[model samples]
Every structure is written in C-alpha cells, then in structure tokens.
Target: MLTNGLVVDLQQKNMKIALIGYGKMGRAIEDIATKVGHQVVLTIDDPDFDAETLKKADVAIEFTTPQSAVSNIKKCADAGIPIVVGTTAWYNDYNDACDYVLSKNSGLFTATNFSIGVNLFWRITEMAAKLINDYDEYDAFIDEVHHTQKLDAPSGTAITTAEKVLANFGRKNNWVHHENGIGSSTNELELSVRSFREENVPGTHTVSFKSDIDTIEITHTAHSRKGFASGALRAAEFMTGKSGIYTMKDLLNE
Candidate 1:
C-alpha cells in the first residue's frame, strides 16, 4: 500500500505465502503482509501438517520451534517453495537446510533477530569492536533479556554480539554463559553474556565496554514485535526471485 509519488511502479507479483506457525509472530506477519498486498494462502499448525496445502503457496514463512524448523524447511524445499525462517535454537542444522535448498534450486533466508533496528545495532557493534581492538583499554560484555516464554538462553542477539566482539577483538575467542553472579577475573578479558526472562518483555540487548577511566554502552530494545513483523514482510518482498542463503543484512543492502 505504498502511495508516495516517488515510489517505484513495480508490478505486483501474485505471491501466495504459507505461514508455518500460527503463533504471535505468524499473526503479526499476516497483518503486515495483508497491508502490503500479499496473500496468505495457507496456515499449518498441526503435527499432521499437510504439505499439499503448503505446495500451493509461492513462499513459506516459518517461525516454529527448534524441533520442527528443519523438517518444515525440508518439506517446503521438496515442494519447490522458497522459505524465510525466524526460528532459533536449531541452527546446528542450518547449513544442512541451506544445502538442501541449494540442491533443490530454491531460496532460503534465515535470521536470528529480524528487526531492522536489531540488524543496524549488529553493524554498530561490529564497528565498535573494531575500534576497541587496537586499544587494550576496554573490556566488553553483552546482556540480553526476552520474554519468559522464550525457549533459548542467551538470546540469539547476545550470541551475535559476542561473536562480533570476538571476531573484531582478539582478546576473547569464546563465550561462556555467566549464570548466577560470578564474573571473569580482571586479567582475562571476558565477554559475559546473561539472559533474563520476564513476562511480556519483547527483547532487549546491551553491549558494554568498560575501562578504568570511562565506560561505553550500546543498547537496542524492542517496544513491540511490530518492527520484526514489518521487517519480515519487507524480506518477503525482497526474496521473490532470488535463490540462496540470505540474512537481514542482505535485505538492508538491497
């Protein structure tokens, strides 16, 4: 429903999207998709999920659990339907799913955190890590909090931040979940990441670099899930004809 004068007169491709999980994320994506003129052709929530119905969709948006994400991707790949997965905790099989999609000549884009703001925050964290790499004066740590219903600890955002810090800074090569109240010693640079579960909190991540003189911190907090929903809808628009593994960074680049 873009109505601006500068908007590109792109032809409206008839896209039939199949929603794999009809949970909160699914419902939000449905709303955003409809607002932007796409159709939700099918919705599958039962264990006895019908692949035939999913085959009718041009694309599938999956937000299921760790146990079912790979299977769902495999079914859709077999049906020749491109997919975008937002589910986490099943990433051990992520490259396997990418291989399956490539083998079938299909498209797959997966993201740990789908919010545009979160993606930008990731970029900023990388830049900060590079800046701190040359100076041994700062030590970094990450903390993330999500809703109590979230299944994974050290939410995906925290892990991404930790990885960025490790990649740009040589001080830390791995991350350990700091549960309870224990922290790493002063001599060792530790990227302490902690997760908190509370009711109704969408998501919040904080990355801090500390030193004796001053401390620098960066944080991004989601007021609601609407931002992620909008980003997924935009991603669907971007993945129409492309085939390969993609991320929110690719969407931003486009």
Candidate 2:
C-alpha cells in the first residue's frame, strides 16, 4: 500500500461508487474509476438529485462546492455510505459533518488535495518549517497558483501547508489569505498566503523562507487532475469496512 511511506496504487477491491458532484473533479474520478473496474452506481450533478440512490453505492466520493459539501456529506451519512470528500473551504463545519457521519456509523475520509506529491510535499515542508523555526532570522510565506475557475482563493493545499508551517513556526500563530486585499484580522503572528489564478493551471504550491542573506523555497506542481483522481479512488478503496474519520495520513499509513 505504501512505497517508503508514500502512497502508490495498491487496490484490493472494486467498489460501487457514488459521485456526488459531476464537475471536472468528479468526471476525472469517474474516468479513472471505470478504467480500474469500479462501477459508478449514481451521480449527483444537481441539488435535487435523489438521495435514496446513495444506498446503492459502497462508497461516495464528494467533490462539490463548499456551499454544498456539508449537505452532501449528511446525505451519505444518512444512507450509511462511506464517503471521501475532496472539497475545500467547508472546514468550518468539518467537525460537525464528521461527527454526524460517525454517529450514523459511517466512515469519512477527506483531504484538501489528493495528489500523492502534495501529501509528500507537506512532510518536506514540515521538515523545513521545523528546522527554520529554531532561528528567527528567516520569515516564511506560501504562494499558490490554480485555475481561474477555482472557487477558493488561496487553494486548500496552501492552507494545509500553512497549518504545517504554523505548527512549528514560533512567531506565527495563524495565517492570512491575501485576496483583493489582506484578509481580516491581520496581526504580527500571521503568515501570508498569496494566491494567483491563471488559465489551464492544474495547481502549484511553493513555500519560501526568505532572509536578508538567502532564500529557501520548496515547490510541488501538478501537471493535471489525474493524480488527484487516482488518489481519491484509492482512498475510497481504503474506506471499505472501516469506520471513523480518516485523512491522507491514515490512508498512506503515515
């Protein structure tokens, strides 16, 4: 299942999947899922889709917008279907959503980004953050690029990276996302996460620690959506016969 503590293709079962959002990410997941001999029993493209059909699926993969992620999670929970969520910007309600699923005796697996490289990138970034934290001479910030059509500004990957950074950065207690202007609640302890939108860019995230002497940067760039799609399906497979909340760390056996 893991190659030197990193995730790789290690499938043991073919599952009936319920695709909760038939958008780009959903289509991507379905294409790979079908090629791997998995069946897609149901798809929800509209808000009015039948929730009863969820019971037909062994696992549900949700890639909907932030506004719709919570309700979709609840429906899967009600159906007693294990769900893997790839949506971002809905984390404020994440605890409630996971609690509801757990109460229903269903499993929940969620990730901000499903690419294998991104998961590894977080670890590399953490190592850098921890080493840099011992000295206050360098300051760090995150820079991310995504497609223009992406709903969230700072990309969920950037936020996750910042969380890893904050865990060790002695001076930074929180992160600030820079949109048209600086996000509210600016403070000295806040690290900056700058976002850029371009055409046809899958995604790219860089963490830079800069000082007056030199700058250190680490980056992971995605060429396409295939990596995310494959990882999400593998996560679905991992959810089979499992209960409780899971993340990429758990899936990769980290």
Candidate 3:
C-alpha cells in the first residue's frame, strides 16, 4: 500500500485473519498473528468447510494439503477474500488458479517456504550461480531435510532453490530428486536434489557448488515453525487492499 509515496507498514495495525487448515502451520500462524496484534477470526480444519465463512476476515491464510489447496483458494476468491497460500506440490494447476483468482478480483499470495532466511538464502544461491555459471568446473546440487510428517519430498523450499540455481547456472538442464544419495540421473546436466525426513526437523536446505578442488555450500536451517508463520503474517499484511496473484517476490521486493 503506497500511501503518500511511502509503503504502509501493515504490521503497525491489527488485522483480522481467517485460518484455513488448523494443523501445525495453522496453529503457528495463529500464535504469531495474535502476538503481533492481529486476530484470528476463524479456523477451518474440515475439507468440507463452509466456504462462506472465509468472507468474515480481512485476509485468509491457507496451509492445507496439495489436494485441497486449489479448492480452498477458489472458495476464498469466490468469497472476495484475499488469501495467502503455503501449500506445496499443487503447482500443476497454479496457472489456472491464478486466472480464477484474478477473475474474481481477489488477491493471492503464495510462497514455497515462508521463512525470511530461506528467501534470503535463495537470493544468495542465485547470486552465486550467476557468478559461477561460466566457470565450467562446477556443478550444483541441493539437499533438503524435514520432519517425518512432512508430505512432500525435496520440499517446496528445495524446489524453489533448484529453480533459482537452474535459472542462472547454464549447465544444469533440470532438477532430479534423489534418496539415500542415489539420484539415478542419466546425465550431468541434471541437478540433484537429495531429500531426507527425520523425526522432528522443522526444515533445512543446503545448496552446493562442487568442483574437484573444493566445494562451496550455503545452508539455511529452520529452528521452528515460527519463521514460516511470521513470514505468512507479513504476506497476509501485504495482500490487504490488493487484487491479483502475488508471491514472496512481491512481498520481499516491497
């Protein structure tokens, strides 16, 4: 919100938020939202939730599964509510989802990893990839770890990191998932993303540029869900008074 040629600090005022998906992330967002002077007006856990209730708040934050993310976003858009989505493995329909949200004149904020540190790490990865692209002696790889309960392998965070590296690192053709250090990649042009699931990991992602002499690495480890929650709150704040699809790029740039 540019008021008087200055960005409005949305966190300065209270916001009424509706939470879609009352799981761990939902609870985390609620905790941070309230502590920062915002209100969680509603929480929806059921997939068969009453879609009309989403209209009760200034913005809605969704942390549901991939299977339900599109439906939930459409419902929020239908109800004229701005929404911030934190679900992964749902991008097969992302373009259509954006079209539907835009058609409804609703704002949608989406992110793979909603941690400020992770986003910064991504930027740094991009910078390093760009600088090393012409070196011809380096190859890129990613490793991501999460809690056992996490549904997706490689994680949305790692996926975004791969995208950043691939965009700048000309030698990499595509990203391939691996487990137990075995990627089965047929060619070197494929970037490897190794995935691990442990008992209680919040999340950890590392990007490395390797050569025979030495290796360069960057890592971001999440201590808890608080960073994700906090960033989601900021995204919700940014989505207010807006109507269109937005992402971490928009929020961070602002």
Candidate 4:
C-alpha cells in the first residue's frame, strides 16, 4: 500500500526514521525509505539541528563525516533510539561508542560500506587474497573512484577492502596510499591504494593483483546510490527493537 508518497509495508507496518545527514546519501535514504513503506520523521543537516526531533523516530540512519558521526550517534543513543550508522573513518572511537550504546541500552549498527554488493565484494576479495597468498610473484593494489564532492580520499570502502585483503594475504603487512603511481617497495609486501575523483560518479572500487606474466582484478561499480540507501533502511528495520552494537557482517550473517 502507498500513502502520501510513503511506502507502507503490509506485514511490518511503518517505521519512523530520523535522517542525520542531508547530503547525497541522506537524500538517497529518504527517497528509498519512503518507497519501502517507512516515513522519515526528522532530518538534521544544519549547524543548529534540533536533537529533540530525533525522539520522534523509532530508528535513525546516520551518514555524516567522521568528525561528527560519533557525537551524532551518541545523541541518538542518549535519546533511547536505535540507530544505523553508515559513516566511516570514525572507527578509531568505535569501541567507546559501543560502550556508550550499551550503557544507554540503545541499539547501533554500523558499516564502512553499506551497499550489499560492496559487502559481498569484501568477502570475495578475502577469498581471492587467500588464494594468492602463497604466490609471491603477484603484487596487490587497490584503486577507487568517486565524485569530486566526496570529502575523503581513498574512501571508507577502499580502506575496508584493503583491510580485508591485508588480513588474508600473508605477504602484505601494511597498506600505503599512493597517487599517480604505485609505491616504491617492489620486494617488500605492501598494498598500494589510489583514489580518483570525477564528476557525478557514485562509486567504483577495484582490487588488482599484478605480476610480470598476468593480472587479476575484481571491481564493484555502483551505478546509483539506491543500493546503499536500501541497505541502511534494511539495517534500521533489523535494529528496530534490538540492543547492543552490531556490524554489517553480523547483519548479513543473520
């Protein structure tokens, strides 16, 4: 059923959602949310964003910069609202945030990349890295492209992808960001990641293993923002009545 530009889920009814960012991802979430039978009750983007509006939501989906994500999530948890956070680069404080959520008895779900395809790509990258772990002949690199307006270079998706590969590929000890060319260490095991920004491109991530004889690459290109928006809404639904901190892997496993 549909009502006033809202998608009404026949089985689960409607959920009140609070949007913490009004950027491209935030707008995408709003569109997808209404189409999936949920209502966006609050949107906070400005410097004077009202925290009280968050109380109107049963669950909140937050996508903001690392500088603000932790504090925004803390507010939502303090309000006793469950939240799904898609922000990245804030994992440095993730443990503290989780503790706060537990103390407040609020539910929290977070992802470096919330697009379902990207999550699957993480797993695939791990499997491929493990397969080539013993093959010292090949060197690995990560390259990603995004819109010019993106605030972060290399992106959170690229970082997560690099982390997965490093964890599985025994040869690689660490990753270094490189621009215009690969890193200098030909013999040492290192992963070089590069980022490119273009006009209006949603996202594209590539993992490549190269050797003198051959090359293997895996790429996941996001044609639109809808995939990410959909996943966040799904996370909000999953977290509606739950408690404790969780991750995208946990959500996917369940």
Candidate 5:
C-alpha cells in the first residue's frame, strides 16, 4: 500500500502496466498511474508490434482505434497479460476477445467511456429511467459531443444511455441518429440521440427527459480527458488479480 506519498514496498506485487497506445489518452494514463503508485513498464505504438516485449507487463491498458484494439488485446492475451481496454467501435469482436481471455485464464475489462462521473451518471440515469417508465409523462432524448478527431458518431456513451433508457421504457426498440430524419409516430417513446464534434472537446453526454409540464436534464461534461485516463488506470489495477470479462458497471457496482 502507498502511504505518506511513498510506495513503501516495491517487491510486494508491484504492477507493471503496459500502455498499448501513446496518444493523448495514453500520456494522461501514464501521468495518473504515476500519481497512483503504479509503474509503466512498456509503451507500444508501432503498427507492427512484437508480443515478446509486452510479455514483461503484468497488465495492459489499451486506448487505440477499433481496428487495432482487438489485435492488441490478442497480443496481450498471448503474452499472458491481463488487459483493460477503453477503445470503442470494435465491439463486434468483444465476445471473441472475452472467449480467448477466459480460455487463457487472463483477465479482460472494457468500458465505452471510462470517466468516473460518466459511470456514476449512467447509474443514476438507469434508476431515473426505471422510475419514469410507468409514468408515461416524460419523453427522453440523448445528445453527445466529442472532439473532432473522434471518428464514431453518436459515441458509445450515447449508445449506453439509449440502452439504459430502452430497458425501462417499452417504447424504444432501437435508437437512430437524429440526422437520419426519422420521425416518431408509433407513440412508442422515441429517444433522439445527436452527435457533435468540435475542437478539443473531450466528451459531453446530456440526457433530457421532458414532459408537457416540465423538463429534467442530466448532463455530464468532461473538462478534460484525464478522468477517462484515471479510470482506465483504476481498471488496470482492478484487473491485475482477476480472470474474467468485465465492464465499468462491475467496477462501479463493486
């Protein structure tokens, strides 16, 4: 344990974290890990990587694109390293990755958005949806904004919010981007999720529940990407001794 701003015992299962991507998010993870008494042993950024170098790491935190994230997880699994992945848009292969991890007895955790506040917001949003389900008085909509560099529209956070809303409300069978101009006429509750990309915006997700009488809106705006980075570090630390496929919900609930 860390005490008085010092890592007292270096020999006591010191976790060697490997960063799979060295972009802005990776740098922020390094900073937070250092502050939280973890050591970063390796950083891999090459397009063609070597699994042998990554074998020295006890855990790997990946925050790369969809195309590269799955392959990175595969490499880490082959190297016998537990992994916490924060990459989005590659969820089609998520089940396969989890299967491989389980087969190898290695831990794997993933989150769409790794902001602590966002995770908490998601919990509250779910509770609100359940409470408002029977009311039929409130209509819901979700909006998300991210940096211009973000490739995915609507964002994983927005998708998660829609899922939570759908769980409580029978009206929504699926979510469609508002840009598609799909009108809601089935009296089925419709959630219109819109996405925006601007300069340097880390992330912002707003859930608006409205009625003819009043409107209740909950918004989680990230001032920086540090929160995501910090949460990823916590996930990496949490995955060190575990063997399973987990999500931020598991972390928050625990």
Candidate 6:
C-alpha cells in the first residue's frame, strides 16, 4: 500500500480493514485504504458492534479516546483479530493489553503519532537531546498545539517527545505539564511541556533546548490529518498476518 507517499508491502494477498472509530482519522483511513485496493468491511463508532462484525476484517484500526481504547482493543483481541491503536492517554494499561494480545496470539500495533514526518522528527529530537546531555547548561522543554476538540493536554505526541528527551538527556528525570506556568527552580529538575489549543490546527510539536548564549529547536507542524491516517493504513497492512505486540518503531525499522 502507499503510505504518506511511500510504498509498503503487505504480507497478505489483500486486506480487509475494520475501523473502530469513524471520526476524521477513521474517514481519512477509509479513503486511503480504498485507494490502495483494501476493503473496509466495518466502521464502528458506537457500542453496538459485536465480535462477529469485528472478525470480518483482517485487521482493526482503533482511534478512540482513552476511556474507550482498551475496551475496543480487548474486543478485537477476543475476536481473534489483529488491531492497530492510535489512541493516546491509555498507557497505564499498555502492558495488560500486550498480555491479552499475547494470550490470543493476536497482533497489536500502536503509535503515539503515526505521521512519517513526526517519527523522523523523533529521531532528530533524540539526536539533539544526546548533544545537550554533555552541556548541562542547555535545558530542554516541549511545546505542543492541537485543535480545541482534542481531549488531552500536552498531547500524546508531546509526551512521547518529552520521554525521548529524558531518555537521551541524563540530567532530566521527569516531565511536568506546566499548564499555564513556566519557571526554572534552583534545586528541582524542572522540564516543562506547555500545550495550546486552537481552532482547526492538525497538530504541532516543538522540542527546544536553551542555554545562556543560544537556543536550539526542532519542530514538526502537521498540515493535515491525512499523514496520520495514511500511516495507520500502512500499519494495518503490516499487521495482517503478524502476532504479538509491535510498535511504529518496529514497523519503521522493518
């Protein structure tokens, strides 16, 4: 299938897709899936969908809220179907979800942000974070912006970026969502992520490191939702015959 202009190979002869959320991203995935010769057998946005309906597809793609994500995923697993989850704010049960998939011997793929450019941007952020590790004077912070309708603050993308920074930069231990405040204290390891909500913004993320003399920043501003949708389609295709848990990093590395 063609994903964000890149071609990907699916192990199956053809794919039958089941979308668990029929919102903007789900609609975008449906458009791209049809264009690439896949069939969307089911599109569920409500609670009436059953396990039989879910089993009709080769893979299921979920894009719901945290409150609904795990239940939808477990249902797909119960149906013995592979699933791709794009929802955020539900990492607290990620391990349990993995165990469920493993028990069923079913496939599960997930990502915080499925845009190809954003995944590449993550690599760049990691590189910059490593460079800043040597120079402790350069402190790092994150800023994210999304549409008003988006539920979570600081964004799942921003949180992932912050985790990437903390992994590479030794001085940082935790990230604080400074909702409306930004200040550096003398003793605390304060790394803040600020979030903004505007109208019609697809998404935006900035990772910045500042010192006394200069500052460095890397930013990724999504022009539309199609990139995320395209990546999800690609992930679904990749998961057609796979088992166990996988991630966007694994897909990219493959």
Q: Candidate 5 — worst ten consecutive residues by lDDT sum?
A: 3-12
lDDT of 1 by residue, 69-130 (tens): 99998888888888888888888898899999999888898888888778889889999989
**lDDT string, candidate 5, 127-208, tens digits:** 8878877777778888888888887777888888889888876666777775322344344445688887778889999988
lDDT of 4 by residue, 108-172 (tens): 99987877789888889999999988898988889999888888777889999999999998888
What clash pairs does model 4 have? 7-37, 8-37
lDDT of 1 at 225: 78
Q: Which candidate is the best by TM-score?
A: 3
| lDDT measured at residue 91 in model 4 versus the true structure, 0 to 100 | 85
Q: In model 2, how large is the Cα lDDT of residue 181?
A: 36
Overlapping backbone residue pairs in candidate 4 total 2
Local distance difference test, each candidate: 0.80, 0.88, 0.88, 0.84, 0.81, 0.86
Worst lDDT 10-window in candidate 3 = 1-10
Judge candidate 2 against the unseen true structure and give its global Cα lDDT, from 0 to 1: 0.88
lDDT of 3 by residue, 78-119 (tens): 999999999999988999999999999998999998887788
lDDT for model 5, please: 0.81
List of clashing residue pairs for candidate 1: none
Clashes of each: 0, 0, 0, 2, 0, 0
The sequence of per-residue lDDT tens digits that candidate 2 reaches over residues 1-254 is 54433334547467999999999999999887886678998988997776688998999999999999999988888888889999999999999998899899989999999988899999999999999988788988888988889999888899999999999788899898887334543576889998888899999999989899999999999888888988999899999777789999898899
Positional deviation of 34 in candidate 6, in angstroms? 1.1
Candidate 1's error at 1, in angstroms? 12
Which 10 consecutive residues of model 1 have the lowest summed lDDT? 1-10
Assess candidate 2 and give its TM-score to the true structure.
0.92
